[model samples]
Target: MSFLFNTYALARPALFSLDAESAHELTLKSLQKAYDCSLTRGMMASRPELPASLMGLALRNPVGLAAGLDKNGAHIDALGNLGFGFVEVGTVTPLAQPGNPKPRMFRLPQKQALINRLGFNNLGLQAFIANVRKSQWRERGGILGLNIGKNAVTPIERAIDDYLLGLEGVYPHADYITVNISSPNTQNLRTLQGQDELTQLLQPLQEKRKALADRHGRHVPMAVKIAPDLSTGQVDIIADLLPRYGIDGVIATNTTLSRDAVKGLAHGEEAGGLSGPPVHELSLQVIARLREQLGASYPIIGVGGIVSGRQAKEKIDAGANAIQLYTGLIYRGPALIAECVQALKR
Candidate 1:
């Protein structure tokens, strides 16, 4: 563990020197290399195995890598080596996209956070599924989630078409599917969260999932990813609607648009969702409220601003059935996974 921690510490300087997205690409490539060289086991020699389950899927542990980290499912095998119970990839659309623009990702070292408006840039559905099929992680019993989204060119009214296509394409390959309607980067994406729009979106997806389950002879659970920037009423409305629509779970609190926490910091006013410690409290609040409305049995994967084991545990305390990490991994490295698992064990 110390070796891995020290290794990342030594490498952080060089990686940080590059632009954020470039550093991200480099990190993924490096992980793939390390896995190919069979060195990840040494780095993660003591990964704890605290078996658990969520949304009917068995997990080795409840710590998962959230979506957006491996957008195209490109590094599932390599990332699975780091000891995540599950790894979710994509926000992939029905068609390929170049995303927003360069410099869409920013790092705020002083706050140990990142801001990204990458806008679901991905290699489209076919390429995404091909990459997922190439991965051996799921074959090795690692839970894999494929998060689906609509294309930028698709109008909000026609968004369901994109999601339905995404769902059908990814259903057989996924241990679970995440319906991502929360990213602030896409124009008016969050508008789908409205009461009527959400119902329209979920009904057809659930119906499609039912047909796919029968066709594939498997029942794959679907979870909705929601933003943290919602009102109490909004959260309550969603909670009431989810079970009614036959949705299996909810990933509470995607990145936040509020800059209240990072105000006056460099790049604080940037036009994108802010993630890291700044959104931690906001995420916890949403999880707590969702739990109040959804009850103990509903699965809630809490994410946002977890930078420590204590914060990871806090998500559970706030009523998350499981938790995911993204921004924290950027600041704390793989050690944070073991740390979070240990914290959960207690």
Candidate 2:
């Protein structure tokens, strides 16, 4: 086992004893602490090869730390040490808004799942970008994908304004930008996934990207993150529109509103997106559906419920080009990243 895995194993019990959100905060704090102390500096510098080339960006491996884990990009340098091929941070909006009240995040240990309605709570794009620029990881070739969203108070009609602002703010810092329109927590956010709305949203962004690409002399690709709750028809519509809109990639899913697998469990009825093991098969189905529609060459970053090495390989085998993690880190900690990298390399 890797040294980091052993360390996390020792702390796992205590972490599990705390409230889910509290444990999450504590974990992020510890990562920042280790980073500040320079204790993890040389840890994964000799990482074994798990090469991936996605959307014109080079990645050391196919395992990525999903956006919500490092919401404000505050821990990229620390997370980078955990050995992710890429670390995507944020669901940042044009303006910062305190998300749904506390107790917003819940853990369902029995199902090895979690339900959260954090509502895109983040440090806003400016602070998010500042945090990204402060990190040395990107300069050292670490891949960073910034996930952008609209603020809760923003009217649905004006959502594009926020995303456009986020694209502008994060374009230079991000190797790729993810236009997040699938989070169930934000009011009306998921509605943007509809055909007419998606076209309207993506078209403007594409135009802006063209201008940004010219101005910066860099083309930072954009990926659209979708929801697992989508019908096969919805997924197909998205698949057809992606390449047409000039979207660079697609993240197979965000968390789901479906509680099919976690029914009868505590917190099962909680009003939030469900993630972890329960969503595994559902996400895989989305990938299969998306791959059928998107065809082989389009990049698909699979996320939601990827908890082990076997599942990691299973996702790729099911047609995902790469895999990302969030809740799994909470359950298995740093070890999960190494396990996934090892699995994919096989």
Instruction: Give per-residue CA lDDT, model 1, range 1-346, as digits (tens).
Output: 7876887888899999999999999999987888777556566544568898899999999999999999999999888888899999998999999999788999998989999999999999999999999999999989999999999999999999999999999998999999999999999899999999999999999899999999999999999999999999999999999999999999988999998877898888989989999889999999999999999899999999999999999999999999999999998898899999999999
For candidate 1, the TM-score is 0.98
Error of 2 at 157 (Å): 1.3
Candidate 2 lDDT, 1-346, residue by residue in tens: 3667777888989988998889999988987887677546555333546888988788899899888988888888888877789989998998888899989899998877899999988878788888988998889888989999999999999999988898998888888999999999999999999999999999999999999999999898999999989998999999999999999899978999988888898889999999998888988999999889888899999998988999999899989999999988888877888788888877
Q: Give the best candidate by TM-score.
A: 1
Each model's total of backbone clashes:
0, 0
By lDDT, the best candidate is 1
**Model 2 bad stretches (over 4 Å):** 43-46
